[model samples]
Target chain A: MDETIRTILAEHGHLPVEVAKIGDEDDLYQAGMTSHASVNVMLALEDEFDVEFPEVMLRKSTFESVAAIRVALGELTGS
Target chain B: MSDAGLFRDELVAAGLLVLTGTDGIYGRSSVYEDIVAAVDGLAVGAALAEGAVSYRFPPVMPRQVFEQTGYLSSFPDLMGSVSTFTGNNADHRKLMDVAQAGGDWTALLQAAGANLCPAACHPLYPTLAGTLPEGGRRFDVAGWCYRHEPSVDPARMQAFRMHELVYVGDAAGATEHRDRWLQLGVDVLASLGLEVQTVVANDPFFGRVGRILADNQRAETLKFEIVTPISSAEHPTAIGSSNCHLDHFGEPFGIETADGGVAHSCCFGFGLDRITLALLRTHGMDPGDWPAAARDRLWA
Candidate 1:
């Protein structure tokens, strides 16, 4: 699951650094992921996970890290 | 009806504005124009002293260029695309029949391949599609900006003059420009005796996805508006705003910084019509009754 998330980030995050370099708890926005890129990343994550992020999940902190994304995905997918 | 609606009615009764049968559209009187011009002068003067060049664009821009600005996806509710009667003779006859019957004739019209200028600085981005100079570029861009909102609120005009200082270059320059102009906005409004409060604000992004966008924007502290009591003290209207669009325009417009990176952009815009109204509300409806200090900042 983590590897899949990393793959999606690599394809859509548009971060200055590679996903392999980003740890599970690393701050994605701090690593240069823009708001534009963040939207794309969110869409791609939804596509990959087959889950929909709720209105309450629409925040900077929800997508702040790989661990955070996993937790959000877990809640939606009932992992 | 809001207090602004009553105030708008008063302005119309006072011969300051001509009603055009539209909620947010009106014709400005010479006196109204004078005050708007004075406000424009004050804003332009601030940017000019900092060596900002003056650039002007028409109220309409090519739809192709406007599509790249992400305005359609971001603020689709406010976006206005120009359409015209491009059909053949048969379609024209149909349109005429509909118009004569007081029916919807606009459905027959096709895209005019143009869009109403959403903001003064939007049309300026495409013109800066190359590498900028060492320090960057700054301009005082002005145009008749259009938003599709029709309201009785006098401050929320459908068509209004947006006079802004737009800066494009490195991230530092972009952020600094927004910061500086935000302070100037507070000072400028207060200097005119308007009780101003500068606060973090967000654009009215549309749709479910737009909720996330708005949240992200507010979280970034990228936009600030100088609010004043035009309608009421509790619900002050924003007369001016300073925004930092960090590489949002540069990446799409192909604008590069002097140091060979995606350029960042920022804008400090004054809603001229709203500012004029704020002045009227703050000092009396009559410009002649305005204080000497406020008059000197504008008329002088």
Candidate 2:
């Protein structure tokens, strides 16, 4: 799951730094990922995981870190 | 500078906009004024024809009215409040002295009775709280709107003018009004010979929580913007937009529909300056040399 999330981030995150360097709890926005880029990441994550982020889960905190995203996905897929 | 940047410079050189050494603030020359007048005239005329009552609002709305709109929760970053010095003579003298010494004097001013209107339709809602008649109400409003965004790009400005037509009534009626105006907006811009495309869009809601709001807005197709390439093709600017705020303003302001239910509302906004810039970009800097059809639609 971590590898897949990182792969998706690498493809769509548009981050300034490398995906390998970013930790599970590091702030993506502070790492130079913009709101616009976050939207793209959200869309790509939806497509990659085949899980739709409902209105409740569509927030900056949901995408703030890899760990947060993993938790959101876990909740959605009931893992 | 890119072509779009150079075009903005040309607009300044052509005297369409008078520069004030600020990025977003500019004065409009007579030619620019004439063009804006024509555009606004057509827009207001169309709204009047569709049974919309006209109401012109001041640049500032009462701070209380602004607070009731719940804008502070969503977009406090872009909000601008009016303030004035209400000090005694001694305090005034001290303020003057601070100013003379090149010190900050703004600390002495208190928040005034009003704040700069962020959008033209915000104040309209509270004004119509208990005023809706049998079939609800429709309004044609135009005003100078201020935002805190300061950008070098000509299309984006801190202070701008907007002509909006707002509708208050049943949810179905409001949705139909938005749909009808969406096409009308496209046709209106096309008549001016500008190529436009309508797409799902969302407001730049502030902060982390705003992401959820923006997604929900798009997911529900609550907002649609007619975009034309002004600065870049990759990132076209929204010249006009149609939004459906289903009971967002109604419940807050105690506005009731004809059947005594909370009214669903929608608004169609035209960005006058951006449209004029788009015309300049599509046609030319000179209005006289514009295509006959385009000139006829605007001038004739």
Candidate 3:
């Protein structure tokens, strides 16, 4: 799940720097992922996980870092 | 309640506004129209002084343009679009029958190719999708903007006129443009006897992830508003705003700078009717009795 989340961020994040350069808990927004890019990221995540993100999970922190995304996906996927 | 002199009700009593039986929609009286025009002129003059080229647009924008701007995904709740009755006679009969029966008649209309413009700048982006000149360009644009927010508060109108000065250029130029107008918006309104305050602000982006988006915008100091007491002092209405869109439009529209980098953009914008309301709230409904300074500044 973690690897898959990183792959999605790399493909959809639109970050100025490489995903490899970002740490597990580093700020994606600070790394140049724009609000629009985050929307794209969320959509991509939904497609990959086959789970719709409930409104309660739709927040910045839900996708703030790789670890955060992994945790949210874990809850949804029970992986 | 009438004796308490509510501002919205007072405008109706003075024949400055006609009730439309809708909370956010109102028919403008000649007096209200005159005031709206005067306030729009004041904002226009500020842009015109900077040699900004002017453009006028209709209230609706192309559906393609709306989609490209990402307003749909970010603000679907407030977004509105045109729908048309493109059905046959039989379909029309059904629609009418449904309507007469107090059923959902709107299900018959097909989606039109245009969306009601939420901002005046939405139409301007497509025209700006190219490499800029040496120092970039300034455009003064105006249009009727639509949002689906219906409210009993007179200041928060569903349809309003926005007069904006937009800049497309480098990142530094965009931020500088926003900063310059942030001060200008307050100064000009204050000169007219409005109690103004410039505060950091954000657009009402939709949903929860939008919270992060809004926070990032505020953290970067990307938006500001010149607010004044329209209905309440504690919850002042935003009469004018400055936004720095750093390549937000450029990336999608391919607007490039002289240096071949993505062009940055900014807008110094205001709502015409809201400003008129602020003026009325500050002074009175009658423009003739307004202070000479305010009157001269507006009519001059």
What do the candidate models score in CA lDDT, each in turn? 0.90, 0.87, 0.87
Q: Candidate 3 lDDT, tens digit per residue, B1-300?
A: 422137678888988877798777889988888888888888788999999999999999999999999898778888889998998999999999999999988888898999999999889999888789988999999989989998767888888889899999999999889999888888888888888888999888887667657866777789999998888777889999999988888889999999999999999998888999888888888999999999998887
Decide which is better by TM-score, 1 or 3. 1
Q: Write the per-residue lDDT of candidate 2 for residues B70-122, one digit (tens) a residue.
A: 78877999989999998899999999999999999998889988999999999
- Ranked by DockQ, the better of candidates 1 and 3 is 1
Task: Give the deviation of candidate 2 from the true structure as CA RMSD.
Answer: 10.4
Fraction of the true interface contacts (Cα pairs closer than 8 Å across chains) found in each model: 0.61, 0.26, 0.39
lDDT of 1 at B268: 97
- Candidate with the larger DockQ of 2 and 3: 3
Clashing residue pairs in candidate 1 are none
Better of 1 and 3 by lDDT: 1
Q: How close is candidate 1 to the true structure, as a TM-score?
A: 0.96
> lDDT of candidate 1 vs native?
0.90
Highest lDDT model number = 1
Using DockQ as the measure, which candidate wins? 1
Kindly list the per-residue Cα lDDT of model 1 for residues B1-300, writing each as its tens digit. 778888888888888888999988999999999999999989889999999999989999999988999998888899889999878899888999999999999888889999999999998889899999998999999889999899888888999998999999999999999999989888888898888888999888886677777888999999999998887678999999999999889988999988899999999999999999998888887899889999998988
- Scored by TM against the true chain B, the candidates give 0.98, 0.97, 0.97
